[model samples]
Target: MDPVDSSAKSTPGSNGSNSASSLPGVASPPERSNSQSNKPSHIAAHRQSFAENQRYPPPSPHAHRHPSFTQQAIQDLLINPPSNRHANTRYAGRDWRDMALSELVPDEAKWADLDTSVEEATMTLLKNNTSNVVLIRKTSDSKTAISTFDPSDLNAYLLVVVGLAKPNEEHVAAYDEISKKAQSQTPISLREIQTLSRKEQLVVLPADSTLDGAIEAFGSGIHRILVTNQSREVTGVLNQLRLLEFFWNEAANFPVIDRLYGSLLRDLQIGTQQIIAINADAPLADALSLMSNEGLTSVAVVDHGLNVVGNISTADVRHLTNTTSLPLLKSSCMHFISVILSERGVERGRDSFPVFYVNPYSTLAHTVAKLVATNSHRMWVVESASPSPSAPATPLLQASHPVPTPAAAAAVGATSPPAPTILIPPTTSTSGPQSPLPGQSIAVVPSAALPGSRISGRLTGVVSLTDILNLFAKSSGLNPSDPSEQRARRRRSSSSSVRPTIEGGRTSVDIRR
Candidate 1:
């Protein structure tokens, strides 16, 4: 991982032979046409001057194109920064891509004893405003070993208790039974939690490990990693969201990366269109089951016309940790999402819960900002159903009449009486990993609109923090898709492992299958 030589100069020969390919780690350019040789010397030189700047077309969707950041590309970028970059910003000389993980501050580690009751753990989550708690075994004197648990675990536990207690007097009896169990001080066992929903693997890394290394770990399906000190004591927790936020906050310091912020998400090939979603009218229990079965953090909530209204996330399950909210499981998915949003508003001292979505044409910088602003892990991709296919689609936020915030809706209610309709082409079928693909039909108006808001779009796809981190890793000249190779190379190149063992042993976990 040497910095590329920015001073090198090379010319493409008359036959279009790329001289720069002779340099170490540079790929050969594609062949050129004979017509280029017919041009005048000045024009030919002018064309050749920008030859190395041209990028190869991205691989086809089915093509097995291994991602590689060539030295030549790095050199070109260093020599000439992208035109979109902010001109007054000064370069820091050192590449932020190679910045150590310890440089970026992480949230303080939160833990609970394994013997702690489920009710107590719920209180920890609420009080700390954290989504998860690490459970550790404890003796009379000290704590040992660790396992992760979150709101989803509580939901899973309640589902089991409620299902078994069903119809002794309808769901009411089951609800009461769950309430009684929730109030009990029964210990949360590691064995029982392990048997429940598949948990996201938690790994440990030394505080000195590079941010790019963490990116590789996350790309390999790890949700978070614990940062440990010299004594192997857990100091803080680092996750994809925090890592992304760090990059966004310091974009100007890293001019090389800052220039890429303006690229459209579609052009960057950064998101997935294969969305897993639930109908708004379906029972909340079904959505929970879908998430646990699919090992997902959240699922999009779509209306009958397949238009996205909101989402159901495991994080939202925290609101249901209490006995009072347990019965929400039997409620419609839409109502359940509404309840979660309302509760979140109360906690945050605001009543604004707008739908989170992005258009395909959104800039990567804008997408990351939205994720950080909303404190969300994923954004639903929504697209307008325009009457003319060739016409440009304007994003909801960029429109002349932007969707009003909750507070402003009342002020403008008189002028705009009719609700703005969110249009989606009618679909006779559904689409998702667990459902059939949707078929095209005539445009259909949404019947179940979101309460107190006017916004319109059809759900098209999803993009997550992991996808964004993978892009960061790739841009930093690390291939995140192959974590093993990256780790192996890192080990061979460095004197020791990222987490070196001292008097206390290095603590790390690799539970990914």
Candidate 2:
């Protein structure tokens, strides 16, 4: 098929170029998957200690048994003192940590010792509104009173001083070491992102394409869609959310259908923004900024002609650099890739190359589930000739791929790795015929630069978030052998291959390479 013609223009309804950025529940109709796991109220492995034990115990080991004594010991001792013991029961009125000093020591005056009975000490404390026994003990020969609670710090009425006494120096050092270790333990990248890439094919649908028509063309249970022009260029993004917005807000408020749909489309304009682009020379920082800001799970990479040479997404960048430290921010956007798309061109990539493709229409629900299962934001929409989109939405259907359980994960090892979604499929054409992998940068180019630019020859890979992070942000020491590591690993890499299955949907993802 001809490479994506970025020059194709969008209609007025699109966000700018993306006209179908809509939701399902919000707008027009359609529908619906799943694992067998039941949703429980709480799924913790162990029980909670504080579930019923509501009282706070003291540091004393036997405090729980003598609860009554702990609560009212000072009261009894003060009211009725022993003959020989010094009655200082008034000291129990409140702990020093919970007292207000301003109310206790107003004007310094001659203080009596706390060597009297509880009743007498209580009267003196109440008279001065002071409950501090330390005051009576400290005399002219005692140490200085430089250690005082600052009133400003007690604005909350209660002050909890943790680590009141100096902690062990060794313990403090260990704590610091632990904190440093956790912050720096990032995932490491081993595979080249360009090794995994794929493409999506979208058909031009007439405004009147029936709900069933969309399903048959794409798959059974579809939600989000990308609207394109006659030439198959992206015009807008359409999904249940956009449709729901129109259904409840825009379309609902209007009395007529024409104005309602029009208003809804205008409001959710998805075309205004330019697709994110980055050159092969840019740093890894640029890709991070785009993902963090634009929230793009995967971004398309284009060269000077606005052509889609290759796509460098989050996964690609991850595999390029090491997230364990910091991303590589070298020269221009071109120098950014953690793992470069083969620098020697497609000739050197004969044994390995990136490929692009969408999930099969028959198992889209499973594909979407995989996307959701791993928090993957990318999936391809291919121009498949198979499976008609004529069925209605079936919400009860399970959208997961038919894969064995975790117990079977071991078998994947003995078997050959599954085919991956590589942008530049393996082909022995190292001759002068010339097939250069696309310039692999994970940022979108401006719309103005797309027209007439040759993106087809830029690169041949479309990397995912996991790939990029693994390469650029990951640390060493992490396990690198995952059966699922064939290509589709995302956000985080695993030691095993995964066939993620969404509950329902038509969009399926394939990791090329």
**Best by the TM-score measure:** 1
For candidate 1, write residues 72-120 as lDDT tens digits: 8776565444544243233356676567777775646666666555444
Q: What are the TM-scores, per candidate, against the unseen true structure? A: 0.59, 0.21
Residue 304 error, candidate 1, Å: 1.4
Summarize candidate 2's per-residue lDDT along 320-419 as a digit string, tens digits.
Answer: 2111112233323333321243332233632222232222221322322334333344433223222213331110111212222221233244454332
Question: Model 1: residues >4 Å from true position, as ranges?
Answer: 1-91, 129-131, 135-145, 164-191, 344-349, 385-452, 482-513
Q: What is the C-alpha RMSD of each candidate to the true structure, in Å?
A: 20.0, 36.8
The local distance difference test score of each candidate is: 0.55, 0.28
> How much lDDT does candidate 2 score?
0.28
Cα misplacement distance, residue 435 of candidate 1 (Å): 34
The numbered model that scores best in lDDT is 1
Superposed by TM-score, candidate 1 places the C-alpha of residue 239 at a distance from the truth, in angstroms, of 0.8
